[model samples]
Target: MSPAEQAGTQPELTYEQARDELLTVVQRLESGGVPLDESLRLWERGEELAAACQRWLDGARARVEAARRARTPDEAD
Candidate 1:
């Protein structure tokens, strides 16, 4: 079994890694040389990577918002 499977969680990908891989997937799909089956698989993987990137961005945004709310009015100036 994979380490993540053993750990009972999927491996965590950094936002940059997911975004870079999503770019590669997009490039491959755009290049138009892959077979239909491979293209479909790549498209699915792209979706997964995009979701991961979005989750990372959303978490970061939430943290920033929380920090802003926590700051005193004087600190905001």
Candidate 2:
């Protein structure tokens, strides 16, 4: 299946799943066995997966920060 098709099949993958797939894409690109054209295609897919993973991380960080702020006790003299 094409990269776009494969990616569309997993629109809501967890962070770990996206990360692992991104890593695999990177390794395939770096292995130097794929043709230049194929490598470029993989690179593009890797970029998309990385972006998805980053979005997940950013959202999680925001949630954690919000939770921390909610629990922090106010300082008093």
Query: Please, what are the lDDT tens digits per residue for candidate 1 over residues 1-77?
Result: 33234436578577888899999999999999899999999999998888778777777898899898877476646
Q: Please give, for residues 6-52, the per-residue lDDT of candidate 2 as tens digits.
A: 45655566778889999999889878889999998999989888877
Collision count for each candidate, in order: 0, 0
Give lDDT per model, in order.
0.82, 0.79
Question: Stretches of candidate 2 above 4 Å error?
Answer: 1-10, 74-77
Q: What overall lDDT, based on C-alpha atoms, would model 2 receive against the true structure? A: 0.79
Which runs in model 1 stand beyond 4 Å of their true positions? 1-9, 73-77
In model 2, how large is the Cα lDDT of residue 20? 94
lDDT of 2 at 29: 83
Candidate 2 lands at a TM-score of 0.78
Cα error of candidate 2 at position 71, Å: 0.2
